[model samples]
Target chain A: MRWFWFDRFTEFESGSHATSVKNVSLAEEQVHDHFPGAGTMPNSLILEGLAQTSGMLVAEYYDFQERVILAKVPRLRFHLRAVPGDTLIYRAKIDSIEESGARVSVTSHRGEELQAEAEIIFAHLDRHAEQRQLFEPNDFAKLLRTFGVFEVGRKPDGSRIRMPAHLAEAEARYRSQAQA
Target chain B: MPTQDEIFHKVQSALVDALGVDEDEVKPEATLVGDLGAESIDFLDIVFRLEKSFDIKIPRGELFPEDILTNADYVVDGKINDAGLEQLKKRMPFADLTGFEKNPAVQDFATMLTVQDMCNYVASKVDGKA
Candidate 1:
């Protein structure tokens, strides 16, 4: 099976982070089978959304090597039911990357409303069943160019932080939200 | 030589057939969940299709406590460990063999999927560390 939920990547960085989007619709049949009458997007899929976003980020780091899958999900939570007509924006950042594995944090949003969040860890191995290895950085620069980079964190004063150049506009957006 | 483009095209063909959508609609730009309307179960089916089509194993995992993010944060990181492979080696009830060829899930909103969902499922079944 594959992670088919992440539309395509809107932005990506091999070693740092990535971003993608998903547009949910009422026409989705899973909604009907899940609740019958109400038919809400399942929490598992929501998590899948996060995993896929982060998985690709990890894959880009590997230059789409063998393949990246969820080895384990240490934590997950669903704050609300995502119904049709909601466009979910997924963002993921690398917390750390090592030869054996990597860890990442993912967040989802619907027009500024905090929808979901998760932390993911991934390991890379060959399809031939060899031990895990460090993914290739062959496409790192090209991939990074495709998806711009951003800075995330908070200032000492408890204000949010942003990148100086790449994400200047995004930084302003987040800061504005912080003030609001 | 097996180029990435070949593999990508194969993946795309499986998606087009399994989802019953137009091949043009199956571009890399398409989002499985958002654009395709795929859900978890449907995603499982897509995995089965890809495995049969590509003859590969896909790593699979579920949510635990430490990986929770907000709803919009759909980023997960993990390699399909030994445990995950064992689970997938077992029967996959989520997949349906009957309507696979015609893309029973296509345009049905009942069955489209994002690319990542399909990839992870395939990753779960892969025998990466054997």
Candidate 2:
């Protein structure tokens, strides 16, 4: 099974904010049997969607170089549960970013109504975990490409965001290694 | 510059939000980790909130000097030596090191910060006394 919670990015602006959508469907086993009878999207999964939305945004700030992890959700308030068939639109905006980590304020909306609002803190593994590889650079870049980040992503000046060459080079290296 | 009460209030709010503790629980002498149940990750969250609330730039290792504690020159057998204690004192005058000076065990360092100490730090930063 995949850990993808959100479907795709509709708006992705570099160093600022991004919006992603998750369609709750009863076809998903968890939603169908979340309460045995009620077909509702689990709150935890909703939080995952929110996290992914913000995590991707934070990772892009460094061209996906830093090992960014969800450190804490300082604030998360849910107003209502999103049932299957309801689309949860997650909006994540970077509050601050520094060498230590970053803070993002996010909101999940069902159409025009707000479902949840959260303040998420992501910590970069810059200190002790510097020597460890949190993820394969190629897989990471491919995931970002699959998520349509480059398609909708824009720089601060409204230019299209480009994929980092290092990540692409890492992928090319991996492909050559496999072919060899 | 913000007054003492103003700084305290802001610090209190930041701790409350970051630690998910009650406003009444953030006493002047309450230790952040021991009294408020803050974890290592919470410190990062608290720092960001404090920075935002006070509109101040809190450089890493300023509020908490984990580096000094981890440094080999300062730590020996899980205890902070005299040099380490002195470095901590010089960097963190906002914190009262009298209690921590007795043992200077690196393990017990997390319990050193209090609500009032945080307020003092913010005050010093705002008044340019730090």
- In terms of TM-score, the best-performing candidate is 2
Q: Give the whole-model CA lDDT for all candidates, comma-separated.
A: 0.55, 0.91
What would the DockQ be for model 2?
0.78
Residue-wise lDDT of candidate 2 within A6-39, one digit each (tens)? 9999999988999999999999999999897899
Q: How large is the C-alpha RMSD of every model relative to the true structure?
A: 20.3, 1.8
Off by over 4 Å in 1: A1-3, A126-180, B1-130
User: What TM-scores result for chain A when each predicted structure is judged separately against the true chain A?
Assistant: 0.67, 0.94
* Candidate 1 TM-score versus the reference: 0.42
The stretch of ten residues in a row with the least summed lDDT in candidate 2 chain A is A126-135
TM-score of 2: 0.94
Q: Write the per-residue lDDT of candidate 1 for residues A1-180, one digit (tens) a residue.
A: 223575656665556776787878777777668888886877788888788778756664544554566765544666677888888888898865544456678888888888888766566554667655433232333333333332222333544322333234444566687899
Clashes of each: 84, 0
